[model samples]
Target: MKNIKLIIIGVLITLSSGCSPELESVNFEEISPAIFPQSEDDIEALVAAAYYPLRGAWWDGFHTTSERGVMFINDATTEILMGDFSVQLYATFHSFEPIHESVTRFYDDFYNKISANTLSIDLIENSSANENVKKIGIAEIKCARALLSYELFDMYGPLVVAPLELLKTPLNEVPLARLSNDEMVSFIEQDLLDAAEDLLPPSETNYGRFSQGMARMLLIRLYLHQKRWADVEEQANLIMAMNHYDLESDYVGLWDTQAPVDSNEVIWAIPADYAGTSENQWQLMVLPSNYPVRGGWGTIQSSWKFYDSFEADDIRKTNLIAEYVGTDGVTYNRSNPGTNMQYGPIPLKIAEDAARNTGITTVDIIVYRYADVLLSKAEAIANKNGVPSQEAIDLVNIVRNRAQLDDLLLADYADIDTFNTMILLERSHEYWCENGQYRADLIRHGKFSEYNIDLTGAASETAAHKTVYPFSLDRISEGKGEFLQNPGYN
Candidate 1:
């Protein structure tokens, strides 16, 4: 919270942070103990700080940070997105090592976020705010914590989660120890469950704030990762029953800044400002370096295999562009299919921007969408029943139909194995590079190793026990044996 600004605006307090250093500590004098806000607006500002890390900055010319960092590892390591020319961090992820700065930064940034949110929770609880305000504030903080912890766990497996009181203490004064996977998962689940109790339902909650549906969505994803099939099914169904969210009919238009605010498709979206400094930076990373709309570095591209995987009629393929009209009145078509270390098809999911030339794009980055819930339901049901149930088939078909693909029938699949595979492939296409869901989906389907089957250069034999990221040497040395690296890295 060192650089965090708790601005008291109209209805809600605007909270924003910049370059959140790992050792950063809040100056209590700003939000003084004597005169902190007792109103809901102030409380909302305090809670909003928890989401700052998700809207990562373009530090180092759109270098990997925040959601981009997560997507970098998730997509680059897999086949959906490939790097171009960049060498040190982003390019190396496809063949990542334990020493990679990207992994370390991701580890550090997320922990700082967890710490920041923890501080917010404690401060909110101790404040003289209304009891109802305290409840909601605390609930939102817990949800934020849960989301951050889940991201860490998804990347690093298990972690040393610092408690609120300990985080308040100077970093040097407290010793951190990694939680066992089960311990971490239990902690995450408890936070989500508690947050759900106080959080408003999706429709009632302000846009971008944590809600009951988001809590359930997180629980569903967590359960899916843990192979808690029954829990996944239960949580997914619970979110579906919220009756507030649904897949947007316009697949390409869903990411539009002008898209309806009440879009039932988005469960949780990190809203970016249209004109201010808070604009989304995603367009610069995935858009072609020469594309006229919002010329990007042309760095992140879809794999040819990925581009080929789509059915001919799938609308998503069109969204994954191979050609585009630039502001220069020049038509650009991708012909050079560079190696994994270079270019391929560009992801145009966040491509349509009216303000691309202005250095900041106003596109709202979708964190969690209803389409995922539907697909997760399909996967969960298939897993729970040990077969492709008709319900599961219908759910998968719902997504495929939206993409204008032919309807999938349970009869098309011979057994649960093939059916589950199809659902995962569907997820890969539907959610590619959309906040790193592609990587998580791969691990869940046990297809992670399939990508590792071929290797060369610095990545040879890299897939061995490398499904999870390694703790940076810096983190482990700092731990002095208290923090253990993921087993394979050392």
Candidate 2:
């Protein structure tokens, strides 16, 4: 676990060759504050490449030195420990156990590049480039930096507050110690806010650069965490005003590879070029034997809780899951086990044919989908005066309409408690496990204490203070105490 800090605060060096015959001619100097712009396009391309890891795939997917694979262990708890035993490594990560090991490494790997990204702004400025290119390069780096922090803070921050015993031995390292849940929240918020100022507007960044829409989405995310109701409303409204995005006629279009970027409700998205550079989320999420065999390397399975959240009345349930065609050659699932086809909502949100990990394809995640913005509006309205407004009901209904549903009933709630609960259920039905957004959402609504209902048996056995994970002892060993442990895990 000592390397946890090393991972979190990753280094940026020439991709290592292990057997180095190093040259000293390339000067390593401080980044100058000069503003230049020639490298802007290069910066944009780099940002596009960075988005791959977030999808839980390979290449831009999970890097081994990092805890990217460890998350597989953590997510498995929701499935293997809680669901069917079809996958083993899945449940091994229950809570902090698997998480501690992988995340520490991931932190180092992620930060190393991100920290280097900061220096990128200065390099292009100093390079023989124009002003627009340099400025844009810096902006892209800012966005990259925010994305990296968001990933870490998303998984470990609140969940694993520290001063933890930290991992010691290679095998049995973690022990426990203080709480810094709120502190973690602040650190994450600060990064997003700083980045938003420098990010390019979604329209300007073009195909794969950070845009205003991304910034706006991030703002809403930060505000939600702080319980800054009005600010959430403000940012969401500004984004909505852009009028650039509209819900796709078919909700499932968001995941279609044939679909163009920003054609539907997507405000900002990564363009996974299955053609050149590629990735397949199916490799990480689909079943082993699915057609073409999504790399036959299924790691992250969908949770029944996530699937069941949809009311049979909601159309999203059908469109979101795979069209289960079993050995019988059916396009849909059989209602009963005896039937030829059996299906329980696999990740249709990823590429269909790419369901095999071995396939060459890339699937973009909808970072700031239109529906998400609408929902943020709904949350803001409902959180006002500790009571939901009719405005809140309107927001929910807009999404419901897009989902092919009728009116929502939240407007009738007599008080804030009922209204708040109603909004959460709405959020659940709309955004569970989509982008690993659920964990942060749970905390936003102030239910972090009560919400991690991980049926993965180990969560039940954990110490009450076991919420925040301990720092990786590997990090401590490498970092020499530069990074502190999370609460209670030492």
Candidate 3:
């Protein structure tokens, strides 16, 4: 891992310091493709470069698992996280506009990665490496690109994805418009499908590298968003048929410092370490500044409305701290709530890393899990059937049972609305703070604006157009009127 990081760093430096003085005067007789990617290691490093943006690094990583990351931003927009930070306040109230830095950062920082992946794919394909190496390398890069695209698309609709030809001519002033919805979906769907053909199964792949399971999982999510019920069911069942994943019996154990990176439940987790390439700073995001075990900025907290939605016996809620003794020798809870607890409970999802002297911990940042596949399958089944199905009920029970909760009876959910409500709630309880998909789930069910208004009266500002965030004002201005902002933002 360290070697891969080093190789990526070297590549970045070379790319950034274009036309070095040492090479400027010396023209090569032949710039042969054979000279580069001559071995599997070269291809591996290129693949690692594509994975860099998705890492848990604090500065530029899109999936950092911290305040600057997708999980925090997306979860904050939902009921899962509430706080006084500008981003949190804006997201929580759905009042974010095109100029808001936090809301626009994902697009501004990482959208170019789409072209980066395209360039990498072109490089790997044109390299003199063997077919097998090229196949695997291209597949990994495609998957990484597709995953990033999906996240961006979910948050801010279709993007102006520049093609490889356009990327090649850096000086060209070719302004492009965002892809239409169908074109955008097809673009991402095709990449995942093509990549899955060569991606290794979960059992065969490295812990953090993109795998066939991850590709399929992304497909399921895409299908879910499109409400393509049968498609969701098919893709989810494909993963299940691989028999490469299952739920971790102990819910909280999945997030422990000692948790296995190769757990059956985790379809994909970013392997994090305090030292380097990837870092998981979730512990520092929610823990209060004066907490006894560890101190954090206390940037965000889970709402009581969300906390109360969980059943008392649900082990998933165990990590939520309703009260805690501070290092200042003060006890705090909902009633005597200190600064942190004023909004709600401290959502310390991952176990506290007591040995850590820094903000980051060694806990793997889980992205896709087998539990999501199961729940997604259940949702697809119920929605496809247009009512509660025993199959769907059983699937939901599998997850609930892991949470140490009683099975929900099918008869109880007579209609699709009730069943969907239950499914949404179950999703909220099960996957909160993990990937921030709960907000997407709400929007999918046509309840994003309504739910926020019900939970926080101030969210009355939310509207249908707010479902997808606006393109940043700078991006629109840069487009020279060729690119248009998402509707209603104007």
Using all chains and alpha carbons, the TM-scores for the candidates as numbered come to 0.87, 0.74, 0.93
Of the two candidates 1 and 2, the one with more favorable lDDT, higher being better, is 1
- lDDT of candidate 3? 0.83
**Best model number under TM-score:** 3
Q: Indicate the TM-score of model 3.
A: 0.93
- Across 250-334, the per-residue lDDT of candidate 1 in tens digits comes to 8878777674468888888766665442446667666655576557665566666777778888997776777666656666555
lDDT of each: 0.69, 0.51, 0.83
Show model 1 residue runs off by greater than 4 Å.
1-14, 17-27, 31-37, 60-68, 87-93, 274-276, 324-343, 454-461
Q: After superposition, how far is residue 475 of candidate 2 from its true place, in Å?
A: 1.1
lDDT of 2 by residue, 343-425 (tens): 24454454465433344445554555768888888878777567777788888888888778888675477577776666676
What clash count does candidate 1 reach?
0
After TM-score superposition, the amount by which residue 377's alpha carbon in candidate 3 deviates from its true location, in angstroms, is 0.5
Q: RMSD for each model, in Å, please?
A: 5.1, 7.6, 5.5
Which has the greatest lDDT? 3
Ordering by TM-score:
3, 1, 2
Winner on lDDT between 1 and 3 is 3
Candidates ranked by lDDT: 3, 1, 2
- Which residue runs of candidate 2 sit more than 4 Å off their true CA positions? 1-93, 98-100, 124-128, 158-198, 290-300, 319-325, 328-345, 354-357, 446-459, 462-467
RMSD of 3: 5.5
Tens digits of per-residue lDDT, candidate 3, 1-490, equal 0001112122342210111112222111233444766678667766766777888888878888877899998898888888776888888888889889888889888888788788778777888888998998999989988999999999999988887777666666677888999999999999999988999888898667788999999999999989999999999989999988988888898888985766898888877777655788988888989999989989999999998999999999999999988888889999978789987999998989898857889888888899999999999998998988999999999999999999999899979999999999999999999888999999999999988898789545789998898877888887877788998889
